[model samples]
Target: MNLRVEQRALAQSDQDDVVVLGPNPADTTFETTSTEGAYKILGVRPGLTISVFDMVIGADFAGRFATEPCVAIDFLFEAAGQGWLLDADGERLSSLPYRPGRIYIMAAPKGAVGFYDVPVGTRFKGMDIRVDTTLWQKLGAGDILSSLDEHHSLHIASGNGTWVGVLPVPPQLLAVARALFDSAMVENDDLAFEARALDIVHASINAMRSIQPAATIPPRDRRPLQRARDLMIAELSYPWALDGLAREIGLTQKRLQTGFKAMYGYSVYAFLQEQRLLEARRSIESGEVTVTQAAMNVGYGNPSHFSQLFLRRFGVQPSRLRPSETGKYQEAQAR
Candidate 1:
């Protein structure tokens, strides 16, 4: 393990310390300590590295990493504040809102600098993995790397180029992350660690490939679609028709349908249905409304039909999510 510490002024007569640990690929166990918290890199394999960090900041903090030539995937499991990354020229690359279920992929060449900042007293928990391109080639995944290079927008500065983007973290990928974090508690489970790490790497690559390129709408054409989406979300109970919506948005029906499908990977009605079910689910889970009421709130007049669609989408009946009222009713009956 390689360790380095840097100190910077926080206030008058006060300083904040930041420490980073770089472990060898062959090392099975790696750990680091700082004033705020402890960090661990549990599973280290050739061509891949996995790390978990839990820290509370004492002051405004920023750190930079000089990364090797590789592709890095970062999953933010829990965070209480905001953060951003800077490119080699000290320009901000992107706004990274630190929230649960956020993931980012970075394809960087040698000597790339990664800058991160978080405000004081913010708690952060995350895991990151880095895989070298040569190792990917040796594993017969050269095509995956090539595809990322082709599809990703490159950020070139000072003769270095990096491709980076935020990805949607699906439930399947979250399950893998949970398993990996749990595995850290078991001692001497090298094989298990290795298997979980490989699972994450493969899942990341698959997620990248599954991204629908055609669904990416150009910036200038996005405002009307966003307005349409917002309107749908805001008025869940409103009876919506494609032609009416197109006229309201000053678009033809065909253009509206085509743009909705191309931008969201779903038709307008399909997206509306998804949003209705999701809102109904939230209402039921909150226990403030009955299943029928929740259904009706989302424009479903037939309770039976709503229940069927809800079960199909969420794999459970809406009533199952509602708070139990049986005990109170039983008490009243006995009295």
Candidate 2:
């Protein structure tokens, strides 16, 4: 999860609440003129950082961001639109949308590049936690350190190496996030900040523990069905329309759909989304993207969605990821 974030300065106005997250070279920040958004990045402890944000899109948005290696826990109170994890070549790697009212935990050994375009009037409110707390065999989960069992998603290797887990926000954590977003706490106040921040990490670890890995299924029918699967993997962007795919595999459309569901555990359309996300995750972790020309990399393509209006609004164009100067390292090395 390459979190595209901002640093906030908020104020009340006559008509609407104004949020300004101007560009600053000191810490991580993402800025755009068209969107009305709020963001505040606060340092909770030496190895922990938390950001509170709320925004409403003014145009279709597409951009990329970079980060230092750390675990990302995102709690979205309100959200719209979806994001894509893109690889070094600007191709999408993953597209598992952790929906609104849920917390998304992404454990990355290194930083990544991501692309997403929110609609012209959609809204977003959330808190992002960057973690490198206590260590458990290089895993930087605080409080719950060694309590994680083997069933935890981190213990299992995923298709693209990184693990993304989605969990409903516990009430205790939700209260804290809402308060932070509402600006109920003073920026400089350090009272119980570490404890609150660690609370989030602890909750994330517990939620992650409950996520069991999917059981691997053997090939159901290895002849034409296997051939069909291979073809899909080879050209993920190619629209493997039901009629064409079925004819190529010598099976009826119904048989092909049924066979795909039985073999891959998803419909043909869903499988494409799965593969695109996997490929993107692998590529995103490979390096940093220049962000000179970020394009929409979803399964479907339309000219209007990725238009000049979006580019002018965001002023970002990340084309591909390259080797980052800040190389990967152990959990606590940077701090």
Best by lDDT: 1
Model 1 lDDT tens row, 1-335: 23222212112212232112232322232223222754565425555666666666655345554567777777866565544445657776654445444566777645356555566666666777777767666756566545443223221112246666556445456657766766653344656767777888888777766654443655444556656865786688999999888888777788788877886666999989987887787566546688899999989999999999988987777777765566232223443
Every candidate's CA RMSD = 10.7, 17.3
Show the colliding residue pairs in model 1: none
Candidate 2 residues 1-335, lDDT tens each?
12334332222112232221112223333343466756566655444566776667665344655445556778876566677666777677666553455567666555555666666767676777776533323444343433333233233112233455555444456656655555423454344555566666776666665543323322333356656765775566676788999899888888778766764456887766555443332233233221222222433354344333333432321122223456432222323
User: Any runs in candidate 1 off by more than 4 Å, and if so which?
Assistant: 1-35, 80-85, 148-160, 185-187, 215-257, 267-311, 314-335
Separate clash counts for every candidate: 0, 17
Residue 147, model 1: lDDT of: 48
lDDT of 1 at 313: 82
After aligning candidate 2 to the native by TM-score, how far in Å is the CA of 308 from where it should be?
A: 52
Cα lDDT of candidate 1 equals: 0.61
Provide the lowest-lDDT 10-residue window in model 1.
4-13
